[model samples]
Target: MTSVTPGVPERQAARPASMPVRCPSQVCDLDVLPDGVVVTDATGVVTAVNSRALAILGADRDAVLGADARVALPLQDLEGRSWWTCADPYGGLATRTRISETLLALPGDREVFLTATLGRERPRGPVVQVVVVLRAAAARRRAEQKTSALISTVAHELRSPLTSVKGFTSTLLRRWDRFSDDQKRLMLETIESDTDRITRLVAELLDVSRIDSGRLELRRQPVDLPRIVERHVEGLVASGHAADRFVLQVQEPLPEVWADPDRVEQVVANLMENALRHGAGVVTVAIAGSPGQDFLLVRVSDEGEGIPEESYPMVFTRFWHSTRRGGTGLGLYVVRGLVQAHGGTISVGRAPCGGAEFCFTLPAGAPEHVA
Candidate 1:
């Protein structure tokens, strides 16, 4: 399905023709389409059916080609009603020249996405032809499942923190003098921390939206990569992580790369958090310039059982889940989008210590004004 950007209205003009081509001959040999195509005559007889259509419906070519489409098609709704009888393209209103895409079940609990064009001789005239398009439902179904998962995950994750915030605030207001100063301070601090978590989750959702919609914007400035890494590590250590658990190294004479400072810091924090949460033992982060000409590099690695090489492709996909704890799985996706927006590339590999490794490079980009 095509996403129409918000605030952009579709043009209003004369009635538009369906599917760019209408005749039976034009769509007959349309095995060229990655999707299945089926055409029917005015009397509702199946005139042409492509190989894909046969494969999807599990119908024999000889049996399907000449049969009445109403009987030949094996699709049914959730109520087990025949699709043709319910839709009734031939008997439906002449103004309805097409069927919007709909999901219908086939035999054996399988499903297909179907859309059709009802061709007529003139405006509101008798239906002369019908062109049907079929597509496997797997990809669309997976996308819908992911969207549902995202909503469920975000709701579940937000509920805990929000409940804590409300509970703490209510307790404080109700028993202001009963608690000691230290106890009150701890309650307020907890509230603050939970608020930060909520803020971060909302920010991540917005970033994911922007990245997917091709609307992500960067405010490029010369970034001090080492300082950001140092500060992030310091915070982690202060937050009860062992100081020795992280080995940080920054090579001097780093190349000048203009990038969004906050985004770069977000990238660093996400990688470090991922390493800490998912991997075990020592975590190492190194920022350096390449030896020869210097491609600005940031490498983060951990000493844990390395990720399987086969899993690399899925690491950055939206809503991808792992056995590891925490995060909405948008961190690495946002990290990659931020890196690429700066004209950079990121890769996953295995570390020397037999653990997952992530390396990203910035191509020493200048500001847009200079470019």
Candidate 2:
């Protein structure tokens, strides 16, 4: 996690400890607040500085009060330019102007940004005071930047190879006279493989985008749960996923539930893919109803290294991969989102199969949907 800079105070000549003080209003009690509070009169004069502010800035409160705010505490914009003369809500030129709606990068590795706001009214009141509020800016820009970069990189990297494969396949099919039957078969196989790779990449990208945008619309209809699980098993085994290496034990005549048929297949497929790649021994995919349950339960379990107990909560988070190989980190995230979109929940934990088990719920009745 990147650290955010805290607000800064100004460097000025120190005042003697015995400076006379006057309280402007009850709000002046803000100096006692835990946060490093600083107040400036409408004239830009430091009306009061809290003890916390003094400690944070390494200055005496008596020395800071009655001083020019810009002199006691300096501020800068993102470009490293001084913002002393920025916009002010009050109409006073000499008053130590209060800074509002601004971020002050302090001298430490703090992740929380300090935001100041006007606490005192001007003109009708003292026209010379302002209040500041400090809070952590939970903004996440790095992940957004990384995702954008990944989309661009993946598009460019895959386009050339896919184009070449498609071109050769088209040429061979069009000019069948130039190649023997064996040559044609080989080229076709290459074409099929390339097409499959492109398809997988496209599908993954689509799912990730839909999940990020929160626009993954589901078409829920009553469907047999067992049929969906069985279909995925048959397809995976026929597709050479070591059919005999793992056991897919599922309950028969599973409860019929409402869910998107196609999206459900994608969810099950992604889970099985995870199990096959990360798990050892038998990878079990099971579907059973919760005891006296109003929802249908589905679980995909693997006998691989089970996730550390500490990492269980993070498994469903976007781009959180346990291992460094053959994982997009988006599969479980999208899966959870899709399940929740259908008014359900998901959990990951130790499975009886000995690896990791992902269990999800599908509401037996219609539930509230989110956009």
lDDT of each: 0.83, 0.67
Best by TM-score: 1
How badly does each model clash, as a count of residue pairs? Answer: 0, 18
- lDDT (tens digit, per residue) of candidate 2 on 151-174: 765777588668979788779868
Alpha-carbon runs more than 4 Å astray in model 2: 1-41, 45-73, 78-80, 86-104, 109-138, 152-179, 245-256, 322-324, 367-371
Candidate 1 residue-wise lDDT, 341-371, digit = tens: 8888999999999988999998775865967
Cα deviation at 13, candidate 1, in Å, is 37
Cα-based TM-score, every candidate: 0.80, 0.65
Weakest 10 consecutive residues, lDDT, candidate 2? 3-12
